[model samples]
Structure formats: C-alpha cells, structure tokens
Target: MKQTATLKFIRKHSALAPICLIILLFIRPTYLYAEELKLPDIGDSAATALTLTEEKMMGAAVIRNIRHAGKLVDDPLLIEYINNLGNKLVSVSNNKDYRFNFFIIDDMSINAFALPGGYIGIHYGLITASRNESELASVLAHEIAHVTQRHHARAYDLGKSYQVPVLAALIAAIVLGSNGNELGQAALASIAAGSAQMRLDFTRANEKEADRLGIKILNKAGFDAHSMASFFEQMYKESRLYGSQGPEFLRTHPVSQNRMAEAKLRANQMQLKQPPSSEAYYLIKQRIEILNQPDDKALLNHYVLQLKNKTYTVREATLYGYAIALLRNKQLNQARKVIQQLRKQAPSRIAYLITEAQIAAQSQQYAKALYLYKSALDDYPGNTPLTLNYIEALLKQQKYGRAKSILVTHLRQPSPAPKLYKLLALIESKLGNQVATYEALAHYYYHIGQTHQALNQVNLALKTPSLDFYTESRLSARKKELQDELTALAKKPS
Candidate 1:
C-alpha cells in the first residue's frame, strides 16, 4: 500500500512521525486521530473560580506529585504526629467540620503553607524554630484560618485569565523544583497568598482575618492566644537581625508590627489559658533539630549550652537531644550515661527503650539491640518506629528471613507504610527472589506515583512461570488497577 499524503506531511516534521503514522493507520478511520490530546473537561473559564470539591481534587493530584518529588518527610512517625497536632487546632476552629491533611516538608526554610482543600505543609525548620507548642500551633491556626476563609479559592484567577492546569503546573514546580514560569510562580506565591503586589493587595485582608481567627483558635484550642503575637514578634525581630534575610515564613506571611500589635490586643482581651504541656511537641522538636544537623559541631555545642543552662522546657527531651548529639559526635560513654539518665527519668517509656536500643546498635551490641527492640515491640505492638528499628537490627545481624517475616506481617496491616514496601524490595533482592522483588518494587513505585513503572513491574511478576494461582491473580489485579488509575489521571483535565 502506498503511504498517504498526510502521513508524509507529518513525517517531514519529525523522526517519531513513523511511529505516529503507524498508530494513525491502525486506529480504524483516520480522522479521529487528528484531534489534539486534551484532558477531560475543565469546564468554563470563570476567572479564579474554583469550587471546594474541585479544589480538593486538584490538591489531591498535586500532593501525589509532590510526594513523588521527594520533598515530603519520609518518616511515618513524624508525618502522623504532625497531622495529629494540626488536627487538634482544627477541631476547635470555626471550620471544625473541614477534613485537613497535614504533612512535613523536609526543607529547612522555616516556612509553613496551607494548600487547597485542607492540605498543609510545614517545614522541618519551622518545627525547629518553635520555642513552644503554642508558637507552632499559632502558625498552623493562622494557616488554617486562611483555608477556612477560602483565601486560596478567593485568590483564584480574579481576572479569570489562568485555569486549573496552570495552577496545577505551578504547584508542581514549587514542590518539584524552584525554576518555573513567572506567571505560575506568581500564582503560587499568591497562594502562599502574599507574593506579588496584586497578591499582597489581594491577601492583606485575608491575612488580617487569619490573624484574628488564628488567635481565637489558639485560645479555644487551649494555647496561649498571646503566642500568635509573640511568635510573630520574634520573627519580626529576627528579620531585622538578618537585615531582610530572615526566615522564609516571614517573607511568605509578612508579619507587620501593626498586625502583631493587633494580635496582642486581641489576645489580651481573652482570658489566658494554660495549654497542657506538650511533651510530644518537645520530643519531636528535638528530633527535628537532630535531623537538621545530625553532626554539626556548632549545633551540638549550642545544645550542650542549653543542657548545661537547664533552659529547655521538657528536660527529658532536651536530655534526649543531648544524647543524640553525643552519639553522633562519637562520645560513646557520654551517650551511654545519657541513656541511663533517660531510663531513670522514664523507666518504661517507649522513647527510652528506643533510645537505649539505638545506643546499643551504635556500640555494635547487636544482640542487646535486638533484645531491646523485641521487648519494646512486644509492649507496643504495631509501633512503626520500633518495628522499623527491629528490622534494622535483624538486617544488621544478617537475619534476612526474620526481617522478611516481620515485614510481611506489617504488610498485612490496613494502610501499610510505603517505607515497608521499599524495605521489602531490598530484602527480597537480598534473598534473590526476583519475582517477589519486582512485586515489592511495583508497590513502592505505585505508592510514590510512578504508575507506568508499577504497571511494568506487575507485568514482569506475571511473566514468572513459577508463580502460584493466587499470586498470579493478585498481580493481574494489581496491573489492571494501575492501568485504570493511569487512564483516570490522563482523562482528568489538568
């Protein structure tokens, strides 16, 4: 058969035209293939108009893309704990009915932001900068107030020039990388909701409203309302110290002294409430500090001074931080002494058990570490950190089978951790189980938003001739599910 004239026209423009021509020839009547590819209906362009449901769906898509980009904290414990604390503030807010998702961004930029549909991202550095739980809660409440007030939706294309696709792509840029279209950047910075002049103008009222409501939330949520003002005042002063190179949150949120004064006056009128001491917040802060600079000598020295001066609120957590600093610095004996003190402070605390186990691991006492892990897991069944630590000990001891068994058991839980899938892949590879290895990798890829790779892996698993009937059925179902997910995503308008 002779080649068609249209195929020749397409071929002149590209090398891939051959493939394109072949696809065109095979799709029955050729006219259908001529239509340009566009996602499912994005509806009318009503400039900056987005419904709550549409915003939620959009946020869901952006979140997966962000997660896949590796900007999110990988620690399941930190993720869950932060969400829990954020939820505490949400529960008392005017928007108590809203379903919020909280996450920690691994960045140390000292910022926190609320995205569409109750998705909030807090930086690890912001958590570290917090002097108390109230300060942190105040920030979250402010962000929450933004969400509740529909500021993101309000900031939507006021001129109706931008569409959902632009919004989605802009967020992907911020989450995945810094470089992006100037227009998209402006749109997102506005959702930080304070970026450009127009954004600043658009969001000024929203910011004031957020401050007012945020303080109300602080009081209602049992935090000192004054914390909102105090935290802002601190950041404002720090910005002065840096001569404009202060924390990024200050830039995004733009804390004016007048705004801080208003917050202070509002807080003064409300009866002060003594929020219950948050041991968990202090512990997590200590963990964040350790994470940010695991072995920085200057940071260690700062902690040493704090420990010596008895300046920390949660003395036990401060001690924990000091111990971690020692352990990282190779002061093994000092770390051991700190561990003993932790044990004395809280005889049966899970934190103490985990800390001691870590010390044992560092000391090369694998047997002792394994024993402590087992004992703790026995007490705190289904504890992710403890179980992961136990698996680490097993792996260190070269007990692959035991580690595999524990991993498999964890996999049976509802909503298993993605880290479990990644670890299982590693273990399967070590055991030379190619089929199971691919299957585990597939799950890991799927969780991380690599849909096509997951599809490929499941297909490979199905190709293994030794697979049992049940295993084959599972892989086949998984492949189909991934295929459907890709189709749905592709069909959805950006």
Candidate 2:
C-alpha cells in the first residue's frame, strides 16, 4: 500500500524531475516508524541530541530558502497581525524562553507546519478556511506544542544517524512541495521515493499529546478550547467529502474520528472560554482575499457585488477590501470614497488610514500623503505599516535624509523585515553612498538566503576606495561572519 501511494504521488507530480534528481542523489530508501522509536521524556536528553542554537540555525536556513523562493506573504499588516496573535499564545506557553517567529505562506492550501525551531508558517488558505480566530489560534497552539515539546529533537535523539541538514531539507521540500511548483513537486516526489509516506508523520502519541496540550494552551490564552475539536471535525468532514483529495493539512496532520472525539472530550472537561474574534482577524482575512485575486478587475467587481448585495459578514471589512481592490485597479476616486466612509465609521482604524494615505500617494499628492502618514503615526506611534508607508512617501518626495533617519530608527527594533533592508539599500544608492549601498544590499541578500550574492556584495563594499577604520573593520567582520555561515552550511552532510 505504501508503494502504491508512492507510485500514485510520482504519477501525479511528474514535473518534479529536477528536484527529484537532487533528492535521489542524497537520500537512501529508509523507513523509520514513529512507534518503533522511543520518545525521550521532555528534558535534557533531547536537548543534548540537538542543541537549541543548532535547531534555530536550521530553522533560519529553511526560512531564508522559503523567502528566496518567494513563498512567504510579505505584507506587513498580515505579518504583524499573525505575529501578535502567535505571541499572545506564546506568552502563556510553558516554554517562555523560546523565541517564536510566525509567518504566512502565500499558498492557497489549507495547511500549517512547524519547523525544528520556534518558526511556524500558516498558509493563507488556512486562515481563510478557519471559521474564526479561535480555530486559527488552535492550530497555532498545536504547532507551538510541537516546538515546545521538542518533538524534532526527540526524533533526532531516537534516529541517531539521521543528518540534521537532510531533515531540514526534507522539511523545506515538504513545505514547498505542497504548493505544486516544479521544485516543490520534485522534492515531494523524491521524499516519497525515500519514504513511501509522502507526508510528515509525527507519532500517534505526539499528536494526542499535542492535542491535549494545545487545548490547555488555548483555554489559558482565552480562546475557545473546543476549537481544536471543531477544526478537527471540519477537516474530518472534508476528508469524507473529498477522500484522498482532502486539504493539504489533512495529508500532513492526519485527523481521525477517535482523535476528534478525544479532543472534544478533553476540551469539554476544561473551563471553556469562547472569546469573540478580533477585528484584525476579519480585516486581514478580507485583505488576503483581495490580495490573492490575480485579476484586479475581477476582484473589484467581486467586492462591488458583495457590497451591493450586502453579502458580507463584516460590512466594514468588506468595504476595506473593496478599497484595496480599487486602489489596485488605480481607481483613486472610488477607493478614496470607500476609505472615507470607513474612516468616518472608525476614524482611528489603521487599515482605513493607511489605505487613504496610499490613495493620496497613488494620486501623486505627496504632501497630502505625507501629512496623512504623519498624522496617523502621531496617533499610533511606531506602527510598522504606517512607518513603512511614511518612509515610502518620504522617498517619493526626495526627503532622503528624513526617510533614512526614520528607517534607521525603525531598523533598531528586533527582526526588521528583509524589505526594509532592500529599501535602505535603494535609499543609500540614491544618496550615492556606494559603501552603504553595498552593505545594505548585502544584508538584504543575506536575509533572503542568497549567501553567495551577499558575500559578493560585502566584497564589493570592502573594495570601495577610502574606508574609515571603523567602517573597514565593520565590513571585514561582517564578511567573516557571512563566510563562516557559508562554510558551515557547506559542511552539512548530504
């Protein structure tokens, strides 16, 4: 049956020849069943097998590859919202010391996955498919449990010779493979070749543990405890309807009737709390829906129909999405009118304010856009979306110095997005700061997993004429750091 499944997968994804070739070269046919491996108790034994720092590095490398592949949804608003939601759950989690980074994948598949480290990715489809924030939070909680429980490390502890880099590559391939891209398909096909199972399988014991712990976390975090069971029931229903063609999530995180019943029972025994979903959840869902539509006119028309027919769950969010669609279509007047209505309803709403400012910018009314951005920033200090939009408007108005100052200040915060560095690189280039430009560009490339390009950029910066002692020393140190990282990556066993 496993061989049959593998053959079916290969038949379905024949385009993955290139990636399969690479995988075939390295991976040997091996079957490691979860039940066959004894899971270490949650303690130092697992940590000894794979250090936290090493896990983090592996996760970082995978994330960089994902970014380089353009698989991430880079919208600041969506990213900020997901991170805020994720962090809320993390705050109440048992592993408070672990730093969690949450991101969204652009794929329209109902799936979410946890990397070896505290990196969690949710597909946009999963967000939209969720009935409410509680459901989304439930999924996050489960993934977090997987991470905090050190499941990956425990697995490595059991499978002593399993290469860490190979595992990381397998994870990357699994994630990208679901997107049905050539490389992803190849990776998936290769994985199937190596292990007849096409999906990442955690132990049955692990899934039950995650479900139990995830419910506790959800209840503590003020989400509905029953959401896990509710989501499971939904997936179970989906599987019934579509059989093998069910959601990508089902393929990875398998759901069974017994599991669903257990989750429901566990949740019911808890002090259940069904908190109302946040306004941001609704707004982000609509925003993603609009942004995902490739046809601008179709999006605009769809929104128009929704608004006209009053078919929206949230009127304000629908209007907000409509405004975004109009903006995309360059319908400045229509977009502004919709945004004005939204602002009137909730004047302080950041989404509406940002959209209004964007419309002004699109109309070439730089002063108006700048004023709107400044006013919004004053009200909501240090807001990332507002700050980024403000910087963009400043750049457009040739206010390079102010833009650079504000951007530099923003970069001081932890884990600034890669786009910020790219913007800084552009700003430096425009100012004719060749050294700074190369340095900024190097940072951008480094963050996005293009280590070779980043290294070359650093070399270019070092070769630039007349570097000050501090500048030269900084560049040299950065060059060495990047080189060391590259060397380590190269040393990983195939």
Candidate 3:
C-alpha cells in the first residue's frame, strides 16, 4: 500500500511532466499560444506539414524561448564537451550533413527531447543521473536518432489527422503560461478531454524506433551500445525503488520489460568497443553537480563527504569539483592549492586551465588571468570559453582596442558566435562608434531569432550620418538579409 502511494505521489509531482515531450508537437498543425510571445513563424499545418526550412524556423523560435527563460546551463566548457560528443554521433550517423545543436537545460528533471532542425536539450538531472559517459551518450543517441528519423514531422502529421488544436494549446499553456495550480489544472483539464492515451501511443512508437536506430548509432559511434539497455534497465529499477515515480523521462517515455529485453538482445548482438572513461565527461558531470545546487557550501560539504568516504565513481572529477566548490566559497587559497594538485595530476587539461584562469580573475590577479587565457588559447585556438574570457579580461582592464581586434578576428570565422556580436556591441559602445554598435546589436538580435528587431536595428544603423562605404556596404547587406528573414517568417502560416 505504501509503495503504491509513493508511486502515486511520483506521478503527481513529476518535475517536468507538464512540459514533457511537448517539443515534438512543435511545427505540427496545432495552434500554439506563441502569439503571446510574438515569436517568428511557429510553423503552420500545411498538407506537407514540416519542411526543412520551416523546421529550422521553428527551432529558432523554441531556442529563443528556452534561452530567454535562462533554463540552459551558461557554462561554455560543458556545452563544448556535449557538442563534441554530439558531433561524434552526427559524424557517424546517416545524416552526415545535419547541423546538430545540443544544449543543456538547468532543470534537474532526468529528461531529454529533440526539436526540429537537429536541436536537442538534455536536463542537468539527466547528465548527473548517468552512471557512465556511455549511458549519457545512449540517451543523446536516442534523441539524435529521433531528430534524424524525422519523427517529429510524422508526429505532427498524426496530430493534424487527430484535428486536436487543443492539444497544442495545452502544451503552449504549460510552456508559456503561469505556474502552480494554473499549470496543473490546465494539464488535467486537457488530459480529461483529450486523447492522451493516443498521444502516448504515438510517442511510444517514436521511442521504439529511436531505440532501434540509437543502439545502431551507439555501436557505430564506438560507444558501448550495451550501456543503452543497461541504462534503461537501471531507470526501471530506479523507478520501482522510488515508488514508481521514475525520472521525468520514464514518465513521458514509458519503459517495459519487453522493450528492455529487446534493447539488451540487440546490443548483445553488437560486439562492444569498451571506450575508456571520458575525463571531460566525468569532470563536467561533477562540476554540474555543484552548479545545479544553489548552496555552494552545502554542496561543498556533500562533495567533501563523498570524497572522504572514497565512494565516488571518479576520484579526479570529485577533486576537481571540490576545488571549484572551494573557489565558489571564496576560499581562494584552498582553491588554488587544490587546483595546483589537480594540475600536477593532469597538467595538460583544458578544464584545469579554465579553472586556474577563473581563480586568478576572482582573486584580482588580472595579469595572471590574461597570461593563462592567452596561453590556453595558444593551445586551443578559437576555444569559445578561452576566447570569451580572454576578451572579457581585456575589457575589464579597459583595453578596448585589443579586445575589439580579437573580437573582429573571431567574427571573421564562418559560424561566429552570437555572443561575440554582443561583445562587439559593448566594445563599440565603449569606443562611441554609434553606427557600429547598432550594427553589432542587429546581428546579435538576428542570430537569437528576433529577425524583425534585427532589421529595425540595422535600419537605425544605416540612418547614421555620413557612414563610410565599407561600413555602409556591410550594414546594407545585413539589413537585406534580415528583411529576407522577416519576409519569409511573414509568409509562413502563423
């Protein structure tokens, strides 16, 4: 009886249950409340449903909303590490030219979802929940498989056939609406009158397909494919242990014994590659453990106990986490000492260099921070975190010219960061280059999915009196691009 009650509680209070798998519904013929946000084209229900270009448009819209919510982890190193793993899978997958974009949401819910145009988000809870990098990679591979299979597009077609506009509205309500009872009531109301079971069946089919392809991709990508089945089995056991209140993942993605057995059998057929433990994977997981919890000192004590008990899966990652906790607690000397020990243990590690540079910056040792940043950049040229930090340190020292030069050079690369434009705008503002500042802001807005705003800003830039031909040419071209985007977005059925 007690166990049943616990299971009920888990079902009632699942962290991400309200928003689970709703991303897949995007770009399908469901009228969402995206009108409230005034976002760019949220894709209409065409006979063909989802086109590649329209899917990319929807991805931009979803990314902006998630980003503005500040739910994504802001750390660059963790993002880069996840991207490296994602790229590995993408490189080996059937869709070789896919522009896979992976992101981490700060939520502690153990769930992941794929969006249109190769966008995927994994909750921080999912990352920390994994027993190994392969387990994590398994989840990622599953999500990637969903994207590559165009499962969302087919799901959209199913929704169109159901003619359930309310389903889409309910998802939008959960995502863009108020919190607490309002959210729960909206979800309950939707479920009470909707074909919730049918939706689940649709999603289950996608899950089964993703698992089949994911295990294959996992093997090809050199990950321990068995880890996929193992992780599923572990989640099932964990759900039972937690009174059937499985992770948010299992709440939305139901798992069965038969499914687990099939995954095991398929994985067994493939000879395992047995990749070594990823240093960045473990270290990033530990650091994210500290990052997710609000109280640094409390988390520090938790790691301390874990470290002292010597019960951790990865000792080096624990120590690295301990050092970061020390730094957060303002124990600068202790942090430095611990990081030095870490450096001795792993001298050529990029994470260690980043941590060391951060410590120097925090301790008001700007020169040391600059030197370390430059040194690390020399080794890993164009590294986002290193370059961003280096530019920041220079900006802090009022070296606008140096910072601007570096920013310009970084911007010249194809696929320059959206953030660099913001940084460039800051530098322009400092140097009092009004036209340049607006132009930079324009590009930043455009990249972040606000095409109309970008167009307005570029027009403002072009209005500047007596602009140079070079600057005018660039601004004019940018304005034209933004206009084209806005026109495309306008033509899409809202």
TM-score of each predicted structure versus truth: 0.71, 0.85, 0.78
Order the candidates by TM-score, highest first. Answer: 2, 3, 1
Candidate 2: list runs displaced more than 4 Å: 1-33, 36-47, 157-170, 178-205, 489-494
Candidate 1 residue spans exceeding 4 A from truth: 1-57, 94-99, 148-169, 175-177, 181-209, 240-243, 294-315, 329-331, 398-417, 428-435, 449-452, 466-494
lDDT by residue for model 2 (294-316), tens: 99999989999998999999888
lDDT of 1 by residue, 1-494 (tens): 11233344344435323323322221111111112222234333345355788677666656655666677787755866787788888988878435888888888777776667788878888888887889988888887887887666643432333334334534544443333343234333333332211111122455568778888988998899999888888888898999556876665455666777888899999997867657777778778777777456766797889988988777888888888788778787888899898888676766667778888888998899999989888887877778887997898888999999988998897546677898898899899999999999998886665668889999998998888989989988888877866654333232
- Model 2 earns a TM-score of 0.85
Per-residue lDDT tens digits for candidate 3, residues 1-494, read 12333344336645434334333234221112233224344344345455676555556555654554456566878888888998888787777435888888777777776666787778788888898889999988887877787766533443322222223323323333223243234334444443332221133455567788899989999999999888878888888889556675665455678878989998999986789769999988887877777898898898789888998988888889988988889989999998989999887788888888889999999999999988888888888878888998999999999999888988886455678899999999999999989989987886654566788888898899999999999888887766654443233121
CA lDDT scores, all candidates in order: 0.69, 0.76, 0.70
Best by lDDT: 2
Clashing pairs in 2: none
Q: Which candidate leads in TM-score?
A: 2
